[model samples]
Target: MLHLQVFTFNPFSENTYLIYNDNQECWIVDPGMINEQECQELFSFIESHQLQPQAIINTHAHIDHILGVDVVAQRYNIPFYLHELEMPVLNNAANTARMFGFEYAGVQTKPGFLSEQHLLRLGNDPVTVLLVPGHSPGSIAFYYEKGDWVISGDALFAGSIGRTDLLLGDHPTLIHSIKTQLLPLPAQTAVHSGHGPSTTIGQELNSNPFLN
Candidate 1:
């Protein structure tokens, strides 16, 4: 079974996730730590569990979601994965943070772009990559079939959907992505988002205002 630990970090309260299995092999997603305390917290959890981080991934390159990508990737000496189309978004992260009155070092490491045609493997498990853009030009979500859960960056929230007012964001495209890519999943599948609380697919489908 896959195990997950969530650390709500940074001024943005972004949800960073560490996912691992019995093998102790793990992946870090959206490392949102921005200060010493937050970084130490994440490091402490990994060290305490003796987890071996295999990869670093970002569902999107928005400033709040990637504040600690550089630190985490460097510490684990792992490859950072993001969609190729998000390069522009990644490049603008620091500036965006500044506009928000937050200082971010920005992710300095080059990312290995996720491919729409491929499945990501962590040890023996397979993770499906969904190109659910519009929240950002290259926003994506990770779906684990066996676990029946999706790490949906800033896409679908508990009772809302990702905003389409940011750079390259489009309301229609975001809605379409959620409907066609996310809603099709099983009702019981858990939706793990980049911010706020977790919700099930069924709950969102039944009551999410934007979807309705």
Candidate 2:
């Protein structure tokens, strides 16, 4: 079975994830660590568990979600993966950080593109990539069917939904993407969001005001 570990990081309280299998091979998802302390916390866990990081896979390129991407990728000598369409968002990271009054040195990692056409693998486990935009134009989610969970980056939240006021954000598109790509999952499927606490699809389906 694949195991997931979540770390709440940065001023944004973004949830960073580590998905690993029994073999200790892991993938770091949306590393949001913004300071040395946060970065050390992430590294300490990996070292303590002897986890071997395979890659840095992101659901989108939002500034808060990628603060530590370069650091982790460089530390582990791993490649970074992001959706091809998110390049514009990634390119604008520094400006976005500045706008939010955060100090950022900008990301130097080159990303490999992810598409719905492909499945990401860690050992024998396969992860389905769901293209769900509107939070950012290239927003995506990672679904691990066997694990009955989806890592939804700033897409679907517990009681609310992703804010559609940012650059390229569209409320209508985000809602449609949620209904089409996320809501159809098994009602019991776990939803690991980018921010805030986690919730199940059934719970969101019943209580999420944005959906109703």
Clashing pairs in 1: none
Model 2: per-residue Cα lDDT over 87-140, one tens digit each: 989998888988998667678998999997479899999999999999999999
What is the C-alpha lDDT profile of model 1 across 2-82, one tens digit per residue? 878899998778999999999999999999888899999999999999999999988999998888888888899999999
Off by over 4 Å in 1: none
Q: After the best TM-score superposition of candidate 2, give how far the Cα of residue 49 lies from its true spot, in angstroms.
A: 0.6
- Cα lDDT, model 1, residue 102: 72
Candidate 1 overall Cα lDDT vs. reference?
0.91
lDDT of 1 at 46: 96
